[model samples]
Target: MASGKYLSILALTGLITTASFAQKSDADYGWVLDSSKRSVKNMPQQNEFLNNQYPYPSKPRSMWELGVSGGGSFIFSDIDPKFGFGGGLSLRKSLGHIFSVRGSYNGSINKGADYRLRNTYDGINGPWNGNYLIYGNKYVANYRTKVHQLSVDFIASLNTPSIYRGNPKTNIYLLAGYSILGADVDVDAVGSNGQPYNYTGINFEGKRSDIKSALKDKWDGEYESNGSIRNESRDAIGRSDKNWLIRHGLDLGAGIAFRVTDRVNIGIEQKFTMPFDDNLDAVKIGSANDFISATQFRLNFNIGNSSKNVLPLWWLNPNNYVYNEVNTPKHMKIPTPVLPDADGDGVTDQFDMEPNTPAGAAVDSHGTSRDTDGDGVPDYKDKEPLTARDCFPVDADGVGKCPEPPCCTELREKMMAKPACAITSLPSVQFKTGSLSLSATAKAVLNSVAQQMNANPECKVKLTGYYKGSDKRSMQLGWDRVNTVIKYLVEQQGIGEGRLIFSLSDGGDPNTVDLMGTTEEGPNSIPAPFPNLQKSK
Candidate 1:
């Protein structure tokens, strides 16, 4: 009855605990779902080094396990089959994820009787039947015994990368071991009051209802030997000497375990042990060897050094070691570093780019200054940095030499008319919405603009960027477009930076308009309506 109640509690507890764990969403335990997706590229080189030397690189340390279990034990012998209370304690250590070793001690007490032999002896009037009276009549042939066992087993786990790459909620294992067993046996007989000895009907072969009744009641008789029955002070084989009988045995078992928490687990195991000795019950009449079988429910606890990240060796995958060691070997060395200069401009060796430079000076990224146009004057003193190759000979101010007119008289007149030349608005350059990249058609148009600007060096152009949305992001995007256009003109066309101005329009066609004129009144050199639109840090 007690064993039945224990099974009931175990079933109910497992159901409730499993259901609670099932209710948790994947997001609640992100590590479990993400561990499988980890890649070699993201893992450190040290892990690869460690994996070559160890079975599981991620788990370098593990904890020992201590467990206690209780259940029913039964022995198959000459006597009738019956169950008795049994319990055990064990200590385990893992050698690897799939293999471990354990040492344990288990003890049990049980009773059994042969009704046919007892009935025959009771009916005999005088002579005793040798079959049932191998021992003196003072000791009945029916038996009861207490057994103590010590064993060491090698346990193997089957689950691997599929169900548990690391830690698992459930697992199963098989075990095989050698054991030493000691037994104390006694016999059941009729009492002085003329009643049959301590029979609780527990070992009787009967219907299910009769068995149920037997489990609920205690036996009325006691285990005795010739010495105890005859009221003599002599010692019997197993009754007086606790270590009188000892046997060597082999045990095989299988078990399933469930992790209830990081430090706790619940398991069920069944084992069958076969001993070489035939006198476990103090009777040598049976043809079959004596064997003991136990089915138990165990509660295990992780002892010293328990941590959530630690898992039983059986929960790890040894394949990880081979995979990492072969693929990401650490023999390769890291490369040396190189110097960096973020901006292309010369000068300012630090990583900063100076904006809105004064009139005329050419610089490269290395802080070196020079005049790109070799017009005999330094760029800092030159009025025009991009002096035409055809007009190389220049004055002190570095202005290119103008060609003499065919008619010397028209030279002064043409010079005066040059400043009076009227400048027309350049065709507007359009851009696609949300894009700063230049299209083939846009590039073609900008080529013409570059030519016009080169021809009219005195004239400056205003680049007005516009976008359709009023949000800050949209405004910043417009600002980026304006800057992109300016960068292309300065770098590709060799246009002087001083000749261009940038401005932003909050809401308009999503395009930039380039207006060429000498006047700076309309959007030229005007501050952007929005603050610097660079992204916030």
Candidate 2:
């Protein structure tokens, strides 16, 4: 009936906790969510290393588990085993998500008896035990063992959550370790008369339960006689002539725990203890070693200040923070995607090779007017698309135009002019507003310009830029653009300094620097009219 009340209290506690957690939202943690402000580092950047760019958060410091336990400890040896009471105290700590270690001290009193009476000289019973004393050779086996042990155990958690679950309420684990033990094995042999009880009247051939009942009536419950142990290394307690057998052993076990709150939990565990020596029941009658099995119920508490530390690692899910972040991010800084379609075309500026595509004009996915023929002209402007080739250059209306035949006088004039350059029309290089840096597309266009300039040494190139106002900043922007183009041709393209012209004029297209080749003489590098207006380099 008391168990029922305890179970009801546990259920009510969990229900209240779950309801309280369900009330929380992202806004509830607003007061405590800024990891940057709570950083342990001196500088902001050092703390920002794990902020929004990375998924990890600083690990919280936690404390060890302190436990108190009690249950039954049973022993198996030469005698028939019966349940005994046991209890212990332990401390545990986690090294990581999966492993932990525990230190424990425990003790128990276990008792057992044999129903079939036997002679001390029988081979199966070995030689007579000194615990019989004056009781002589005939005896019924009855014994009680006292044990105390200290052990260090390595524990492994079997249920570390790797998916998106809240902290687990139940933790299951397995453990294995070595133990140092001291046991006092004794026999309840002599009766109150100071002589072994007479066995002649007791039937050794009756049913097991009936024989056990008869043996009980003839015996005393006192376990005052000590069983013999190896004398060389054993220690006698107080003034008693009997000594405890020192033994080394192994403990193998598993357990499960249920969390009642952030600070407390309860667990059930069982351990099978195997001792190296066989003196646990007083007699070394058989070759098999003795064993003890302990089943325990543990109540554990976490020891630490609530404001400074978290619960033990085994109770916290490793994936909890990350899963919540992806679903409802609180600390992320993601920029909105900006897709500017300046010409009302169905494309963004970044991929639109043809800007300012006319409204109501049919265009391809690149925002360029489609052309059927392999000519350079768009279908919207081409009158004779198939006639558009190198020899048949198209006119403004896309009509084929024939070149005038070269006369003798024209040929003589060209020869006398010495070095006449034949260069094609070059494309304009566009820049982002207020940015002087050359983009990859701009650099590729200039590469073709350099190849053409290298082929025609006598050709002089003119670079022209435009600005809206006469203010120093506006004019300086235009000066920077024209000067930049001319420098690229002279310094980067290996063109002579005298072969390039820098021209800055009133508005045409503020973002464009037009390139054209001619024979005009000009200065290649122009001084910045307003150096103070220069933007970032």
Global lDDT of model 1: 0.60
The total number of steric clashes, by the backbone 3 Å criterion, in model 1 comes to 9
Best by TM-score: 2
lDDT winner: 2
When superposed on Cα atoms, how far off is each prediction in RMSD?
12.0, 16.7
lDDT of 2 by residue, 258-360 (tens): 7788788997787878986767876656688888878788999999765655567787767666666677875666688777878755556787788887764
Relative to the true structure, how large is the alpha-carbon lDDT of every model? 0.60, 0.69
Give candidate 2 misplaced runs (Cα > 4 Å). Answer: 1-58, 121-136, 230-239, 331-356, 359-537
TM-score of each: 0.51, 0.56
Error of model 2, residue 68, in angstroms: 0.6
Error of 2 at 361 (Å): 7.7
Consecutive 10-residue window with the lowest summed lDDT within model 1 = 24-33
